[model samples]
Target: MGVFPDFDGLGGIGDLKQVIGALLTVVLIVAVLMIVVSAICWALGASHGNPSLASKGRIGVLVGIGAAALAGAAVAWMNWLITLGSQL
Candidate 1:
């Protein structure tokens, strides 16, 4: 009677969780990339003799990188939680 094989179903929020997980994964990856880019931009923006400017730029870049890395880690952890929850 059915067009395809019988299955339990996705009537639950399984699909939603999967979508959230994928989104989180993407966010994590993007955050990491942005962190790296931020570091590079700081390095390139700094020129010799500008101690104050270079120091400030380095600090800002490091802070940005740290924030991005933290966000990325949180996103990755959330994604993992979603997957584990889906399985169980």
Candidate 2:
């Protein structure tokens, strides 16, 4: 016998999926915006010779990148887990 996820096993699962998808979309948009704004800040800081601002902007950019990477990887991670579970 094989085990797998039953998407229809619960009531309102479809709606839950929709909500999660919307949340992910928002996360990606915000992350992209953060990257753009942080890059601009970085440029301005460097041009004005402000080390503090530049350092903050650099950290923001890294955080934005990390957020995006995690958001993007969520689906793949979930899939991998499901597959791994099924093999047990």
Candidate 3:
């Protein structure tokens, strides 16, 4: 069964697929924005000799990138997992 129940081809919104697609799009956009902001913060921190700020920015950059990658691959990852699970 699909994780989201369809109600007249829409799952609480206009089409479940469209809702998920929009959500993923938003996530990607936020992740890209985070990367840019973090990079700027990293540069500013390093220039001001603030190790704490720099470290936080660096961590944010990494996490944002990882999140973006995961979101991008979520569909493929889910399909793979489902296939593997069915085999087991």
Candidate 4:
């Protein structure tokens, strides 16, 4: 007997996948925007000799990068999980 995931086992699963894809797209767009804005803030802060703003901007940039990475990896992560689950 073959044991595999039945992706069509549920109704509205296609719609759910589409929604998740759209959300991921939005997240990536926002993350990129965040990085751009943060970089600009960092430059302005550094030019103005504002250490606090510069630090905040740096943190924001890092967060944006992390968010983008996570969003990008989400699909792979989920697929990995599903594969692992099926192996059990």
Candidate 5:
């Protein structure tokens, strides 16, 4: 048996899963957009000698990429934790 609780036989969760998938897709798209915008902002700030704007843009880019990584890895991380717990 899997380490995860037996939600396999549960009814109606398919819809919830679909919704979650859709939301994840939306988040990914937005995060990518943010990264693009931040890159442009950083370029403009550097060209204009605005350190503050450049810093903010760099931070935004990092945050957007971090969020995207988390969203992508959450399920794998959760499964890894569960497997470790079961093995212990």
Candidate 6:
């Protein structure tokens, strides 16, 4: 009576757990990478003579935020899909 436990009929939150885990893993990796990339961009921007490099770094931070948000949404979508799939 697990509803959607095991696709193979073994058991567990079945596929939902794996789906969430994958999404979270992607988000975490992206977050860490973006943080490092942002720091580098800022540092390079500070050292560079051109104004655009600094701007690019600032853009990196903004993009990082966007990426994180997108990742979160993707995770949520995945959750929704799982829920929908289970109902089916």
Quick one: RMSD of model 2?
4.3
Report the alpha-carbon TM-score of model 2 versus the true structure.
Answer: 0.73
**lDDT per residue, candidate 4, 1-88, as tens digits?**
9987775564564565677689899999999999999999998999999999999999999999999999879966765765665555
Q: Clashing pairs in model 3?
A: none
lDDT of each: 0.65, 0.83, 0.79, 0.84, 0.81, 0.75
Clashes of 3: 0
Tens-digit lDDT track of model 2 for 3-77: 877755556645655776787899999999999999999999999999898989999999999999998798567
Clash counts for all predictions: 0, 0, 0, 0, 0, 0
Query: All candidates' TM-scores?
Result: 0.45, 0.73, 0.68, 0.75, 0.72, 0.62
Q: Pick the candidate with the highest TM-score.
A: 4
- On residues 1-88, what C-alpha lDDT tens digit does candidate 6 reach at each position? 5555555553455566786788788877887688678868778878876567777877878887888888788878877876786665
- Ranking of models by lDDT: 4, 2, 5, 3, 6, 1
Tell me the RMSD of model 6 versus the true structure.
Answer: 5.4
RMSD to the hidden true structure, all candidates: 7.6, 4.3, 6.9, 3.9, 5.5, 5.4
| Candidate 5: 10-residue stretch with minimal lDDT | 7-16
List, residue by residue over 1-88, the lDDT tens digit for candidate 3: 6684443442243354466678789999999999999999998999999999899999989989999999979856655755564454
For model 6, the stretches where C-alpha displacement exceeds 4 angstroms are 1-20, 43-49
Off by over 4 Å in 5: 1-9, 75-88
lDDT of 4 at 60: 93
**How do the residues 1-88 of candidate 1 rate in per-residue lDDT, one tens digit apiece?**
6686333554655666677668767766775665576566566667555556566667766776676677667767876876675575
Task: Compute the lDDT of residue 53 as modeled in candidate 4.
Answer: 91
